[model samples]
Target: MPFTLVLPDGIQYVGLAFVSTIWLQIGQAVLVMSARKTAGIAYPRLYAEKAEEEASFLARKFNCTQRAHQNTLEQLPAIYTATVLSALKYPVFAASALGLWVIGRILYTSGYMTGEPQKRNTRGGFIGSLCTFALTCTGTYSIISLALAAA
Candidate 1:
């Protein structure tokens, strides 16, 4: 016997959106690397050794850029999982949410790169959080629906 898996329609959109998010993450990492070089920060040292007051503006900016990317990495696993799981039942909605999440992350990175930590909580951040919450709820609903249908 052979095992065959059936995928829902519109799943391609979800896949494309997911790939876009990955590309966005890579772009953020590249920006961090560029900032690190511009700030003269070297590898193995996560941040500047100098005090905040003593650090050059470029150094401070580098730290913020790095942190922005780090925050995205921290959230990626959950976002990816929810995106895929939710697509099982609502592929279009999942894709749209993922797209919004990517846009929000871009805005969040832009604000954070300004070297003002507080600026990181921009409308983009709120949009991203909302999308994540929506995806989580949809994913949970999808799972329950599947289970109930099987029973």
Candidate 2:
């Protein structure tokens, strides 16, 4: 359409990255902290019985319970790094990438609990994973595209 859409592209991209980062932070907080809090509240007896490492022990003990949270924690690095690079290269796609990663992560958590990692991600999880992967690749190619365009 036009060269600029009211705002400069770089500015827009940076702003979007900030918002994406916030969302990522919220997710991290939930996986790292809120989930633990929920575990503590849900299993008062476990906490009482094993005060030391109650949460850790409880999470480890329950099948499908700890795995979900652990999965989210595991995905944080790949997701965040992809988002950063995507945002820098392509803002709109970066947001989409972040959205996909979040959705994939949630599905991954559900899948972890179901004992069938592939099954749980059937609907949204698979799509989200695909989107995240696409976004990551897009971000990588975007850099090359920009360089080639400049050259």
Tens-place lDDT per residue, model 2, 88-116, is 66767777666656666556555554434
- Stretches of candidate 2 off by over 4 Å are 1-63, 114-119, 149-151
Please provide, for model 1 over 2-119, each residue's C-alpha lDDT reduced to its tens digit, 9 standing for 90 to 100.
Answer: 9999999999999899899889989998999999999888898888766841658888889999998999999999999999889999999999999999999999999998888778
lDDT of each: 0.90, 0.57
TM-scores for all candidates: the values are 0.94, 0.55
- lDDT (Cα, 0-100) at 97 in candidate 2: 62
Top candidate, metric lDDT: 1
Least accurate 10 contiguous residues by lDDT in model 2: 44-53
